[model samples]
Target: MTTSSLLSGADGAVELRGPLASRLLEKSPAMKRLLVYLWEHRAEELNEYAIATEALDRRSDFDPRTDAAVRVQVARLRQKLKEFYDDEGTLDPWRLSIPLGSYQLQAEPVTKDGAPPDLAIQDNPPAAAAIPTIAPQPVVAKPPASRYLWFSAAGLAILAMGWLLGSRWERQVQMSTASSSAVVVSPFWANLLKGGRPTQIVFPNPVFFTWVDKNGDTLLVRDPAVNSYHDLERSPSLSGLEAQRGKPILAQDYTVASDTRAVFRLAQYLQPLGTKISPSSSTELSPESADSANLILLGTVGTLAPYQAYLDKLHFRIPEHKQYIEDATPSLKAPVHFETVRESPTRIVAPGIVALLPGHSSDSFVLVLAGYHTNALISYLTSVNGLADLQKARTSHGNPEFFDAVVLSEVNGTTPLRSWVAAFKPLAKETR
Candidate 1:
């Protein structure tokens, strides 16, 4: 009955047939299947493509770049395992974990005291081979000197969650929790946070073209028109630079510092009201998750492309791959186009929009805070003056549950100095 024996087929099959696997099966049949698949194929190098097609039964054409289903499921499975061990499996002599940066299942022995034997923890597994990017054309072999870096959605999620758990924001959240009983929630947030649904705050991981420079340093270029792998392949600018830089690879690893801060600020305000808040990256957002929880999306036009269905319905929106707000309302009023401007070497002016709409599910809601400069958009949305302006505008409009408002922010570099509401319009509930 040694714990090491659990790694054997017979012992493993016994555990799988026991209550542990059954619990996972009860949680999600797909998760149980994934666990069994990993257990059976423990010796093989499990990549995203293989796991998707083989374990998860994804189509042969499944692309890991655009579709994060496999990664999401794996992450959920990992969480489920940790949950099992923390509770029901506390007395189990062995624990299974998927090593970070790899898809292999690992078994670590546990002591009688319910703790692992004293051993130096190993560093994260080495990075895997670059998963192929999604493009219209077939992937061609490239020189080893130049290669793409496919960012993992799970890794980015961990980074984002780590920030949320940082001491700075955690302290602020603690303070907010103390005074939460006396604070009154505003109508804007009240409408969204009603029904006690969990809130998922998604921050964008915008697309960037990365290539190694002549000096052996990696350089990142952001072209507004290119937001996806497909866009990177067809860009006219990339074609000219391909000779020297090879083909530029698309990655969504970088998050604007302002966006992360905004999420913290938002969580600090909402958590005090007994609302559960979760921080996630835009890449990690899925249709099912969006429908199940209240979502607060913060990002630029290119980063928010996945939500184009909702963005299209907004009367005030920055066009795809562009940095300006256009008024699409067809009325007697004049056309509205507010573009980003450079007032001086030290100052910048940008347009932002705050839109509230119904979610995919009837009970869920969506709050989109978008702009060319997210620093300004989020700053305005969370500010007292900015919220007062929004409240005043909504009050005049009879306080519709769904609405869109355009705001202008004066910024110095990445910091937003001040923002003002430019326009507001209430929409019917069925507008979605």
Candidate 2:
């Protein structure tokens, strides 16, 4: 007959405030308060103005007719409720919900297979369908009848609720669809792809051999050393060393083999983000170029110019760049050093650095993927199961935004071997 009678006899009104209410309160205090208030007065003629003032604690002059804040919050509350049921309360026998277009809280007893009871419009007439306007069954109010006031209030509230409920549902559906189609990436790649800037890949062309003046003989310097012979090709002091010493100038060309595999793999990995990596020559890319975009330094330290500058800034030292030597640590116990064993021609212990650092400029990130030599660097980026290994390393280090870790790449020149986290620096503070 009336709104009160309809609500009192409703099938699912009693258990509306039980388990679901408690969980809702835990996640969102505002939603909990709003849901409780609406449930308490579900039977009365509700107006948007009244709901804003009472449940939302807005100012007395707050215009629910114009301000859409209440509608927005209600939409969020519905989404939160959906998440709760989908996750935390998935198996619960009783499901609580606020029906579309109405604030009335309903508790429908789910069947053996989670089927909700049939809530046809006839059985639950109070919770109206999505509509522009709705006339809730009239209530016999105070005498000298405020008929216009009651009707207008009821109409305004129901219209606000009904139209917005349907619209919010659509928005939620769109959001879910968007998220499903969104980019998925490894955590380590996130910093490199930060701010959606163009990513630059610096392929390391290692200095295989260079012209050098050693004593009176100008020789081909294949060894990278601290007291290395002067690069006769580029050194001003050693400009005429080859001619003066009566020796042939060694070939100045030094380049590592192209890692076509890492390039393709990275492209596929970043395809979801709609990013394309630009092939930047190590010599072509200057400090200023590296500062403008997200940089992925490929291969060994040779590929990355000014990497020594970075090491200086971060207080790390790797002497004798040719072979893997013990790092000059800030402390002997510091978790930032390398142990090398020269087995034969190459260093037996090949350690690598997968360091993420802040970009030189805003919205920039510099990812350093380097090692003792070309082989080690290539292994880390491609053959070492890099993405998986690096992700696990990042996780082990508490997943900091900036990190530098020593990855011991146990590889015997392309033969499969294990990798380990030799050392970790979870919080590598950026020196800006």
Candidate 3:
């Protein structure tokens, strides 16, 4: 379809209007303006200089060589368009697109088989397939024109009704697949799942000191300082108690309540996206496993002790007290301390840290979700508005490849009311 035909709100065609009309593009004025400018001048042969000057309002002397503002905005707008098509705009008759290495917006219709009309058939498709493209049916030799004379009007009507029903069925399936793919491409999930690599949902197995009496009475003790049975020897309080209780045996059977819930949620979220999810305890993880898959560590500060080296360079930390998140370097925008605030007897505000760090292998990634409450942290990471807030936070920091942020969640008792990103810091690139 022509650009004007698509934009003119033609019958069964989707319209591309102002920013107010698009949920995904509304937050970005630059992207909205760029989209509208491209649509208005879809017929023109445009370049980066024209887009920079006409759409972005760049200075007349602006140089595209040294400056890359236009390119950056175009890249972001491209991603947003893909995300929009995969999500709320899934059923739109025509899909909007911008060709790579260029600034032009192209519209392609959704063919009956779901693949774009211009898409070429591939010998082999990727394992993480979204919607499979239907192969073209074999062409049969045409018979005499009089062969169609056998069909009656009632027969033709029946065939039309069947086609309508079949088309509706296919659209329903497309919507289902598109929604799942949308999550994989979303801001929060894209980092981990979009790579199409196996994701290892690593949960912590914190050490617990247990004393079993001769009478079959057992007492369990959890000291924050003790990570291994060897570490228990160094703790004076735990050693003194061990002396009276005979001997303390180490146990790694328990996981934090939040970690369990987070694991379940992660499994439910990723499984639908056709992501290969492997759930393992932190104790089972090694350098080799880290090198092969994406890692998502879910638990409290104690659970993060094994990976403390990753946090050494990060600005925020949950100290021994486990009460507040501390920022080593404070700025006017980022506070030194993100302490818990009591809004009322049952309501409180607490801080959580969501850090995306480089893994042992350059291709792999590690996502650390550290917080006291698992529900709020995972809920925030999964929700649309929550991820949108995170996207805004990441944008403010120029959209770093790897970064960490302090997210605040308002909770009433055990229930989380809302979550928002309070501070953000772009992580330094890992040195070889």
Question: Residue by residue across 59-153, what tens digits does model 2's lDDT show?
Answer: 99986435877767777766676666677777766666754533434445565666554332123433222222224332111112221111222
User: How would you order the candidates by lDDT, starting with the best?
Assistant: 1, 3, 2
Indicate whether candidate 2 or candidate 3 has the larger TM-score: 3
* Worst lDDT 10-window in candidate 3: 134-143
After superposition of all CA atoms, the RMSD between model 2 and the true structure is 29.6
**Model 1, 1-432: lDDT tens per residue?**
222233353335544443344364465666777777776654333456678998899999987656878768888878877778778787777677774444656455575666743221112212211222223111111112223322333323333333333324444455445434444456667766778888888877766666765664555444555567776656556555676678776656546545665666567556546778887877788646567788888777767777777788889877765567889984566448888787876567778888988877777888888875665676566556678988889888898878998888876545455677778888778965
* Candidate order by decreasing TM-score: 1, 3, 2
Candidate 1 backbone collisions, by pair: none
Against the true structure, what is each candidate's TM-score? 0.57, 0.45, 0.56
lDDT of 3 by residue, 1-432 (tens): 233433453222234742225678655666766777776554333455667888899989877556878879989888988887777776766677886644556655677766554342222322112212222111111212321111222322222222232223333334434224433435467546677888888776756566667775545555655677888876666787788987877756445434554565456455566777766777778546567688888766666677777767678888863568999877786579888888877668888888888877656788888877665787677666678999888888898888988999876555555789988999977721
Clashing residue pairs in candidate 3 are none
> What is the lDDT for 77 in model 2?
69
Off by over 4 Å in 2: 1-184, 206-241, 244-254, 258-265, 299-305, 325-337, 341-349, 373-397, 427-429
